[model samples]
Target: MNAAKPTASLFQRPAWVALFAFTAAFAWGWAYPLIKLGFAEFGIGRDMTGSKMLFAGIRFCLSGLIILTIARLTGRSFSLKEDGRKSVVGSCLFLLLFALLNTTLHYAAFYIGLSYSLGSRASILNSLSVFALVLLACAFYKSDKLIFRKVLGCVTGFLGIMALNLGGEESGAFTLMGDGLIIANALCGAFAGLMTRGVNKRVDVFVGTGYSLSVGGALLVIPGLMMGGTLHNVTPWGIVILALLIGISTIGFTLYNKLLTCNPMGKVAIWNSLIPVVGAVTSCMCLGETFYSKYALAAVLAATGIYIINKGKK
Candidate 1:
């Protein structure tokens, strides 16, 4: 008889999970500078709201189509079945709303706030999404544990964010409105992440992403049209931005979903604390921004926190 294939030991699984999470976070980090670049090229603030909306809409629609095609080609079943269709539909709706809030408010806040704050500061503040999710998970879903390791992880991550913030140069006006908008963006992202956990149980992650991006992108069209952004003036750079967005949505979410199959959501989220550090580093490299000592400190803290959180957790 042929020898049985060796199954992966428990020790092997966490390593693989951590690897996947790190890769996902890296790709997501790269996307931040790309977004800023796109905004600069497209004259984000100068562009009519309608134009921005239309630009976002087209990108997401294309992203959805691409994912759908990939799903079909891979022979992954796309049907929700009658019983789960309603849940899928509801999840899609929430996703659309989440997308709208994230794309509109988050970008708006970041751009506006960037003008007032230093890049380091903005990057740190952006990392607040992790904390927001932790709170939301505790209050609404009862999904996260407030254990010592988790608390330490949160604190360590927050410190890393602060280090990044303190390290960069200030640019724009620091208005209360800008601060509030950024906070709102963090809240929306937290809610979206939490919602994805619930939704993924019912539908494929790609399907959920496709539906959400498509519907959300479509919804932006009406507002875009109202805001005077027609289809005529979109530049090549705009197209590039849209493409990146789609890529992030498909690759980032798909990997995240895959990781979830083998790990707890909270554990996975802890890795996300690395995003700000990655973002700051990438931004410095690509945009010629200064790299500060605080960034190094933040990275160390984030790394230590991840170790504490994931160590020995099966």
Candidate 2:
């Protein structure tokens, strides 16, 4: 009888998973500028909360449907057999909070902030989510250890953020509300990350994602309808954006879940620092935005921070 070949171990699976996660982060980073463009096309701004909600709702709904179809065609099971009730309940709560805070605030605030701030500054500021996650991890879950190396990494990353900010034109009307919204958006993302850890303990990742997206998308539609975001103004470009959102969400979230399963939360969190660099580069290249020394400096700092953080782990 022929000897059976050994299957890849869990640790071995992470190399490919981490690579995909990084790619997904890069794609998502580009999505910032794309979303900004879409909002501009629609003449929507931060003050247009209703319109923003509507736009986000439509994008998520379209993406969710596409993901559902793809999941089915791929022969991936959709049934929430394990913790079906808990998953549904948890997903519903997550959806409500996420749509209300994370989705709405993130898009609206980001667009508004980008108008006031430079692309590099906005991108680097966005990396503060890592800081938020770190604090949350330390306080709530104790899932990660807070050592000198991690602290150094975070400090370096913050310096990158500072570099990016220093290169940008300052917004004169920096309101408490706007800053609050951005901070809240980061907190929501961190909370969502934490919540996913809990949910994944019981259900499969795809099923959980499907549930969250469906419920969250549906909730977003209600506010969207109230805001007059009809099917009338959606252009071909809008449709393309919607399609990309779904594709990325499906692939990115799935891969992220796999990575989380295989690696420490802190390690995965550090990868987030790469997002700003990717976003800034993509925006400059695709949208003809200008690049500056500050952006390069920020990238270097963030890269160094990520390396330091991850190196200490191994």
Candidate 3:
């Protein structure tokens, strides 16, 4: 008889999981600078909320379609039959709600906030999502209780966030349109992270993510168009930038979803600390933004917090 096959993919291995998580974080880090560059290339201005929405919509919508197409080719079913006695319509409604929370509101807030904030500062602030995820996971998952270490970690991390206001263009007070909206984005993202665990139990991660992106993106596009949104200074380079953004969404979300499905939420998410560091450094380097001393302090604190959280309970 032939030997039994291992059946597990490399991604299932702990080391591989860590590697993929880092890679996903690194790719997302680049997105901050690239997005700013994209804005400039397409002639998108800070006040052009409509155009911003439309641009983000196209990137996510195309990402969804590409992911779905790949899933189909790999023979993954798109059925929600496993989601229990809920009708197909009910399942779809749930998905739409998820899409709204996951993609539409999430990116809508992000794009708007980024327009008003510096890429470096915005990236660091976005770490709010990571901290939110830890707490949310504690609330939702019995396995992810808030240990002393976790609490300290969160406190330390929040200090890093508070430090953001001490330097740079910010005047140490939150702006309603800028910082508030980004915090809103972080809340949406935290909820989405929790929701993905439940989603993966019913449907393939790729399928759920695709529908969320596509439908939510379409929702953004409609409002954007109604608001007279239009892309300006479209060029080959702009198209390339858009394509890169799409790839970032596709690859980053897919890997993240898979990791969340397979690992403890806190374990998987603690690595997100790397995001602000990568994002801040890359944004300064790529966008020529000033790297303030406070930014480095924030990154260090954030990294230290993550280390404590990941150290695990004795």
Instruction: Tell me the whole-model lDDT of each prediction, alpha carbons only.
Output: 0.63, 0.64, 0.86
Q: Which ten residues in a row have the lowest lDDT in candidate 2?
A: 167-176
lDDT of 3 by residue, 190-297 (tens): 899888877776678789999889999999999998998899899999999999999999999899888888788887787778888888899899988888888888
Q: What are the per-residue Cα lDDT tens digits for candidate 1 across 1-314? A: 99999987442377777787787777777766776666566666533556556656666667666777887788876666454576766755655565565444444454445544444445555667776666566666655566787677767766765555452244333345544555566666677777765545556666766666666666666667777766553589767766886788667666765564345666777677777777778778877876667667767776676667666776
lDDT of 2 at 72: 79
Ranking by TM-score: 3, 2, 1
Per-residue lDDT of model 2, residues 1-314, tens digit only: 99999887553466765676687677667766776666666666656666766766766666656666667788876655455455677755654554444344444554445554545446666777776676567666666777787788778877866665453354222234544445455566676666666555555555555655656666677867886655445678876766676666666656665565556666676677777887788778766777777778878888887787778455
> Between the candidate structures 2 and 3, which one is better when assessed by TM-score?
3
Which candidate's lDDT is highest? 3
Show the colliding residue pairs in model 3: none
Clash pairs detected, candidate 1: 50-224, 115-171, 115-172, 116-172, 116-173, 118-169, 120-165, 121-165
Candidate 1 vs candidate 3: the TM-score winner is: 3
| CA RMSD per model (angstroms) | 4.4, 3.8, 2.4
The model with the greatest TM-score is 3
lDDT accuracy of residue 285 in candidate 1 = 83
lDDT measured at residue 81 in model 3 versus the true structure, 0 to 100: 45
Segments in model 2 whose C-alpha atoms lie over 4 Å from true places: 1-12, 73-117, 167-180, 230-233
CA displacement after TM-score superposition, residue 43 of candidate 3 (Å):
1.0
